[model samples]
Target: MNSSRHYVIDFDSTFTQVEALDVLGEISLENQPDKDERLQELKSLTDRGMGGELALRESLSLRLDLLKANKNHLAPLIDVLKGKISTSFVRNEAFFEENSDHIYIVSNGFKEFIVPIVKELGIKEENVFANTFVFDDEGKIIGFDKENVLSSNNGKVEQLKALDLKGDVYVIGDGYTDYEIKAAGLANKFYAFTENIERDKVTEKADHITPSLDEFLYVHKMNKAISYPKNRIKVLLLENVHPDALQIMKNEGYNVSLQTGAMDEDELAEQIKDVSVLGIRSKTQLTKKVLDNANRLIAVGAFCIGTNQIDLEECLKKGIAVFNAPYSNTRSVVELAIGEIILLMRNLPDKIAKMHEGNWDKSASHSYEVRGKKLGIVGYGNIGAQLSVMAESIGFDVYYYDLVEKLALGNATKCNSLKELLQTVDIVSLHVDGRKENKNLIGEKQFKEMKDGVIFLNLSRGHVVDIEALKNNINSGKVNGAGIDVFPSEPKTNKENFESSLKGLPNVILTPHIGGSTEEAQENIGNFVPGKIIEYINTGSTTNSVNFPNLQLPILENAHRLIHIHHNKPGIIAHINRVLAANDINIVGQHLKTNETIGYVITDIDKAYNIEVVKELKEIKDTIKFRILY
Candidate 1:
């Protein structure tokens, strides 16, 4: 390993968990009703495995055109981004105090979003290298620096070569650009971080595959600069995750294993015998029994959005943190929704079917324009909220219904009840959560309340609506056309055959739950989700944590520290301090926080503590688990 000590990290899918550009586009074009088609196309290209640089170029151009996105649009986008910062970002003030000089963010993504995030991480503006955006006199976003080397293909390697840093250059990221640093021989070591997207090419080329930055520091003996092989993480790639994910884990020096095809609970348990990190998609059913057998499983990777496949409660009981791709596929799902809305209004599905059967039937009277239509949205979370603004921009009078309060955007109106929204809107879309109570939420009664010939879309969850009821509603002419993406009982693997109840209906659109299946979204997903997982495992940071104690801190240097996980009770901190005081260890710095059930404390001490302090700290009545970081 080259001993020169500087590190470079990617932004999109590498630092932030989602593509900020895509999120900005969705938020900015809330008033444009005509750019939906282009948005869909952009999302598709990204999901199909387009490189981040290319995906950003196409998507950014399309969004900027639709948005005329200027400075005014940027403030709201910044708010959205600030609220959605990465979970692994070093937020500890002390950690930043120690390591700020060595960390750098090198990205092809826009400087607008990157600057704020880096500033939050305590990295100075001078430490960040990114593409700059240009706005016209009208304040409309025009273009980026085409001449900037970082924006070009292989730009990361070129940028690093120009840096001429003293120490070994260590690159961490989830894209081909980051991998190119290693491939080009500019960096001494490249870490393939799968916490975001796992590219086969990048993983195959990486020197190490790290799930998180914490893992990287731990492996290098850097955090506290101590070496211990027992702390080495062993990862198991179960069914459903891409092969690239496994390769990256192996490259990272993890004792990695892979199990192909589906397995029953017993087989799954047997396979995870020694696994510490379990990676899976929707296929693998991580039941309580399976989890009970996994003595060493510390984490679960639900590679997809919906976590219904995994037993979250069971995992939590075992202290296993779970991570999923929530916003990674937002653009893909929104694009598909927009396409379906246009298709359904135009009666394109039926027209295409007739044409394919060699029937030349031309009827414009039955087709209507998407513009000037009423669009009703249910469960205004990430996907629903995004679709709302996009639909409104396309001239659709947007009405949304959510159980919880949501901030209104553009011309979108909020209906207090689902019934009220259904009766008033021409198109009804489901984007609710995957809660059990949501099953059959939009069955016959809700459909009956909808205006006759109303368009319907279900891009959320299969269980959110009754498929049989939806099919019946279409037959009775209560609904004009429908787009159904997700299903209640989808086949786990790509190889498995899928059967659906809403198979053959006139003017009905059936997609393979591909609302988020665009190449852009998938690559973002592959690049983003794994990065979050990796960051969490590496840094003990959990800004986007679905479970476990949430601790945010600045990056820590080579100071010996004790991380204590305990029951969130009163006096836990005092007791921890007492133990340290009794051991006579000097406390250089300390930070403490608590979630629902657990309290986490990171105490930086002078690098000469006896092992007895750790032993005594673990014996505290409230302490759940403890580890030393040195």
Candidate 2:
């Protein structure tokens, strides 16, 4: 291994906490209000998985056209970068000072923006290789240099080749161009720097993946080793999660303590003191103070779908990564919805209650079969759509209403409005998301518009429906019966007992938010969610992250799996794979997947891997961590 291997890194999310270019564009167009529309388009393009280069090109051109931002605007933007350097970057300045000669900033982003940030980081200007932004006579940002290789396709690879360094070259970035460096054989190694963004394709091809820069420095053996005291990571596992989840975390070498009951904020804080990782279902209240006292905390695991129990913004500011099981439990929730809908339509709960009370009321008048009945669904996301197909298979007509357009399955009808669906269907099931707008969505007005004696169900967010109004409707014979699972104010910890407003109501079924509480769902979650949490902790792989970047990679064969989870950006995978190819390590199989906030990639190598490769992988910028997974 060459001691002088040049490390080329990308800017934007790869080096910084956020996308500097995107932020610049947003700032440049702040005054032009109409430019906000274009900014949003750029955001969507990036959000929809467009690589950073393309998003930057499209967004930059639009912003420049709108603001004509020049040197003056650049100053404030530079201030933004200087103000918000990634925390890891600020903490590891000695690593940069020591390895300044081997480091290079190779970015397609404008040097005008990159220069100031590099200067602030104390990197010499000569060490930076990026595109230069050309300003016009009015000091306004006008155009870019088309001739610059960094501005073109596979430009970073081309630029590295142009550098003509004798030793190995490694690329670290969060964009497609960074990944291209390895494909072009320009760099010896690529580290998918996922601290900022983890793209699926990029991670699939990389030799190593990391979620934080600290992991990079540690893996590379580039920083001074100080004997720091180990911070104990105590984890709290809550209800609705399979017991195996805690077992798996324990298997993964975590210090886990299980508590079965629920606790308020003060009690939870006391219990979680000296804890680093907190795990919960829908029942845990990860309040602001809870997070504040959880100073040792690095990550959070919401064992269920919704993260409303946790404060997301506080977690982000506190640099805590929150993981949730978005799809692992989808089938469980959907199956329950199908079963509950059928039960409600057939008055099964009502019949069962009567049987429990020793009243054998075998009357067929109120008990109707689910077949041929219309099922109205609110929110056609994963759970709702799956339920639609299952309901249709059972000989029921499905009608769905969603704010956004959704693809219908089977003979499902897409209602133009919620009211229209409410008026037309016999069974109304709620599967809407846990957004703020969904609170009190199904209230008195909507209930009054529903068909009399219509059966109602809510397996989604508890706040989505007005439970008080639902109870009234059920009692008044307007709604024949109801099934309530999720609640607005749910107990935070699992051990805490619950009392519902609709408790003991006639003809109503009350479940403890167990719509996804099937044995299979629990097992799947037990296997997958905790696996993701452990992977993120061990290797920074965010394969199933609900709020992070999306990286989807193909399964690999013989290679030692290297899982990387980073912020979703661009060239991270290219950097990782480039490192492997440079070391002559062949990739056998790979798997990559991502969400809105994290990118996860699993790579397989063909032969026994070296620590050097992992070390080099960690050196890439924006890396969270890299680990060997057997």
RMSD of 1: 16.5
Lowest summed lDDT over 10 consecutive residues: which window, candidate 1? 222-231
Assess every candidate by TM-score.
0.63, 0.53
Q: Write the per-residue lDDT of candidate 1 for residues 552-591, one digit (tens) a residue.
A: 6665665676777777789988988898788777788888
lDDT of each: 0.74, 0.74
What lDDT tens digits, residue by residue, belong to model 2 across residues 1-630?
Answer: 235677787777777867765677767777785777766765655544325445445544554565556677788898888877766577567667777787889886778878889777678889888877787788777778878877666677678778887787777776677778877888877788765566786788787775556556656655522111111246777654688897787654356777776567898777766787788877677899887788677778887778887888667555567888777788888787777766776778868988999999877777778889999998998888888998899888999999998888888999999999999999998888887888999999999999999988899988888888888888899998888888888766555679777987877888887888888877877787777766665444555555554344433332456765555558888888899899998888666665454455677777766778878887876665454553
RMSD of each: 16.5, 21.9
Q: Where is the poorest 10-residue window by lDDT in model 2?
A: 224-233
Q: Count the backbone clashes (under 3 Å) in each candidate.
A: 46, 68
